[model samples]
Target: MADSPGSGAAFPSQSPRTKKYSLTEEKIFYMNCRAAYLTVFKSSLENIISKDQLYLVLQHAGRNPSQKTINKYWTSQTAKLNFDDFCVILRKEKPTSKADLLKSFRQLDVNDDGSILHTDLYKFLTKRGEKMTREEVNAIINLPDVNADGKFDYIKFCKLYMTTNEQCLKTILGKLEVDSKLKCQQFGSHIEGTLERDPSPVPKPSPRVIRKTNQEMFSNKGGSRSPLLSSTRNFKTSVSLTITMSANSNQNPKLTEPNLIEDWQCVQSKGCFFLEEDGKIISHQYRMHIPEKSMVYLTIKPLKLSQVEGKPSPWLSVDTALYILVENESQANLQPLCFTELQNREVFGWTGELGPGIYWLIPSTTGCRLKKERKPVPEEALLVYRDETGKLFLTKEFRSALSDIFEVIDLDGNGLLSLEEYNFFELRASGEKCDEDAWAVCRENFDTKKNELTRQGFMELNMMEASDQGGDPRDLWVILHSMGYNKALELTEACPFVINIHAEKCKPRIKAVCMEACNGQLEKTICKYVLTNGSAKSMDGYENIIIYTYKHDSWITSVIENKLDNKLIIHVNNELSKNCVNNKGLNTYVVEVAPKSTMVCQHVMPLNERQEWIYHFLSSIKWT
Candidate 1:
């Protein structure tokens, strides 16, 4: 669920060469490449945009240009620059103004003496431009007149950085023009206060139930996808839901369009799947066929400044894992709703399946991959395992990383797919749920149409399931390391493996049921109304390595099954209490198991829904 900020390929302010700029210079050069993309990788990276973070955002926006003018936007077909080619770097990029920050402080004031020193304004604000940090040049050398003796005035510090960067570019383009008129409204969007009805509401934050561990990490076989190389106030959320529907007796269960929350608004928890397209409605969804019983009522809020007054915000909201699809005949329960605010909004709920009809909830981040446990083999399966030709051929760098995982599972590209995008890419590579007779055996053995699939039939069905596993790339490395591949097989949504976060009293999250799977996975459906759908109960570990645990009320979703014959190495831990998550799919993980593969290692959950998780999980296995 990656490209959808009304995708013109994720973000297109205009073309024909940015239609000769101006939309306020393409929204201030697309907000200085989104403030150098939240200063080089927001929740830490992987929507690709490097050339040293666009020459450190054009040397901190003074635009020093040149590295052969950023090597003509790195072509060979633009090597790297997503986020709409890092905001049209394929050409237009001149929006620094205030006379280009006073001609870069008059060429770093080298004796034209408006004033300099303090080691040449700390190497012109850290090695020649906007790389400032050392507490932002000690808050500009402790501001107030600035310089008991150090030095100051380069034309009053370039109008004190052009009056705080033209009011921080008009307060971030007035909060992205009110998030671009509530994502170009057709309807629904109201939250400034008014959601008061609570006899008892704020009591839903106690989900962190995990169990599976022995802990380990090796990596070295000259193979397992390249000798295991390893590597957030990540506060970015978008909430807007208002589903309300009540019916049991006094009629009114069929309205259809009276109010699907006024035409659906914000469910964007940045890791989208709040699926309700901007297409004004059709197959994008808007159902209401009830023959009886109904009581759906959702209000979740946050975003209303006259519903984004002028609309124009594209591609800039993604962290991964945000859902709300209320489809149920009940199969584990299909989770990811954890939001819990109470009086002013953000709560989420669920009830039975007593039938009659009325179940259109819609909102998803693709049922975040869920979790498990076990022992023995407990000390040989580390992380990376090379496979230098141990055979699952395909290489041209694995078909350009499986055509970038089929353009991130073709969300709405029209190349084809949709059975909810191959069951969200078969639940992040096999944790289960592709049904419809396995999408009709992937539309009768590949290359489908109308029945969807396509993209050369999803790369000829992953090269015929890696040649029916006889060429075993462990189901293509569990769909390329659970969608963030690396074996120099390149793809990096970056940071996840302890990004030196130090919150101390609080703060640090990234776990919407972090994917890691094995075994015929599909259990975490809110504890399957007390275990039923595949409840073999207990068959104690071994039989080709396995790990299982899927309890949820707030967190803990794991699954792993590698009916081993070869490629093995598992060691997931994710402790889940007083939660300290360091991402790579939750704490202390070291994966590489592909024999008869089944994956989804972790997706913990918290960072909002009124924060409070104690999730747990642990596993141990290793033996080639």
Candidate 2:
């Protein structure tokens, strides 16, 4: 893998990346649609709007505005405005009676608490003045939105009443269903859509890294300079995380496969052969798709002639050479990164970690020369691994897993997953959501029906994913595992993964840690990363689970022991923490632990690279 004697030059320097790509116009339109939300709010919403905050938001959002532009609007640093005040600043006319109505309600808020208790309001409306009925008072309370504390903001209630409760009711109704009738309505998509316009802040699937070939370094196969592979499945030693699917998926009790699931082709993940027969080499170039931030390892395992029954060996006893080809995003430019030969070790090749973007891996004998064979060689098999996963695409096991996923996300029991339904799945993975523009991309690329992703289309999409990631299922596992699917791919009722944070620093925060689990994709991902074969309805059945959080300088370690035998999946969410020190990293974990086994599900060092480590555990996982 060194400058192949054939490579007249050193490996070329990779092109430097300077800026993020611009977003599509459709995503921009989706983002701008958020303005429509303020329209009813033209009647009404997040934090206080300050010039500094607005400038940061717009700049990060890709507007790249000058301080002058923001200054024109913000005017002064001391000037601050709430949502309603900001609306007035926008010059939208306020309803004439709204202010008077709010003032009148404020008179009833004796505590100046900005809200009136439902009971107090009910007394005022029914016990005095215009003398309204209990029913009428209850009806009005439903308009604005009441806090769980049993109070509603009088001003907000007054504004909603003026705008007509219909708008409030529409928003509330949309929250109640998954596939709402509201055209393209999505929470937080508008703001995020603009951020994606820069593509820098957000990470889509990435291209991955590059590793200098193993030759220049120490070889694994002892004296063999770069023996391709030494499988006792060599990767198991290098991989800290191993993703395996249950082979006996059909027997799993909790996973219900769709009765009407459709079939599609399983895209093959491996390419290349070096078999030599009748004094000639039998080989052709193989194409591989590499996704973002992925590591690709090319390994060829030697198979003895007797081990493979009738299979012939590669013509490798003599020297042979192979070239690795890569193409740019548009497939417009084809280039060779490096070449591998049967140098000291006939079977060895190279490993590399690449960047973000779509690229192809081509291993061919076409461009390289092969030494004349003196004698035949043993059979050889080529294996490709992306990160820690190398599971083949479209196996019976994968199909079973994906079919269950389609069923869970379909939401309405419909065979097709709508844009909303699919975005729900997207959100499950990587905590990012997409809109019609993305859905349009899916529809254009895959086979679809009725403008939604059919089961077949969904399966095809995953196949492309498998192809892109070099057969790594880490991304898919993260979504499913977080959803409550144990290692056996069973969705436990509601058992949650636990988090143990060990920190020595006082006031060390764990910020933005959000965890949720249901029959959804995102939760499935958090749990998916760490799981084993275990199935139980809930964590209530397991006594071994323990939760520990660190904020103050004191260290609290609680390692509870379990006595239960039931297998289960669990997601302990950090997002729902009532109040604690500030935090970073919004993460959801679905963990599976088995009876009598003490497994440290996940060990994450803080991005700050301090000594802080977050530990997660899985409930149980089943492997066939």
How would you encode candidate 2's per-residue C-alpha lDDT over 1-624 as one tens digit per residue?
Answer: 001111111121122332344656533433333333333222112433577665543432224344555564564443543332232222212223677777888888989988988888888888875577787777877763644468868776665566663464355435433333233222221112111112122221111111234333334322221111111112211111111112221232321222322231112221122222111123222334443354433433121111123433332222223344455654556454544322223333444554444333323222112222222224321222334454554665456657766765554455888886676556555447786787789899998999988999988988788677666666566655434343444332111111111111111111111222111221222232123222222233333443222211111111222344764333322221111111111222233445654333322222211233233222222121
User: Model 1, stretches more than 4 Å misplaced?
Assistant: 1-58, 61-349, 353-360, 364-456, 460-624
RMSD of each: 27.5, 29.5
What is the TM-score (0 to 1) of candidate 1? Answer: 0.22
* Candidate 2 worst ten-residue window by lDDT: 1-10
Tens digits of per-residue lDDT for model 1, 1-624: 111111111112111222222244433443544544444453212345557677875554445566656765663444555443444452345555666666766776778867667777887677763366667787776776645477766567667666766675565446534665322211101011111222222222221210111011112222111001111001121111111122122132221211343332212211122211110110112222334343332332211111123532111111221123333555344343331111211222232222343223232221222111111123321222236666444655576656646664554455687787666667656646677877887789888889898778888887777777666565577566555443444332211110111111122221122232211222233223222222221223454444444443334445565665676544443332332232232243355556875565544444333334444343455332
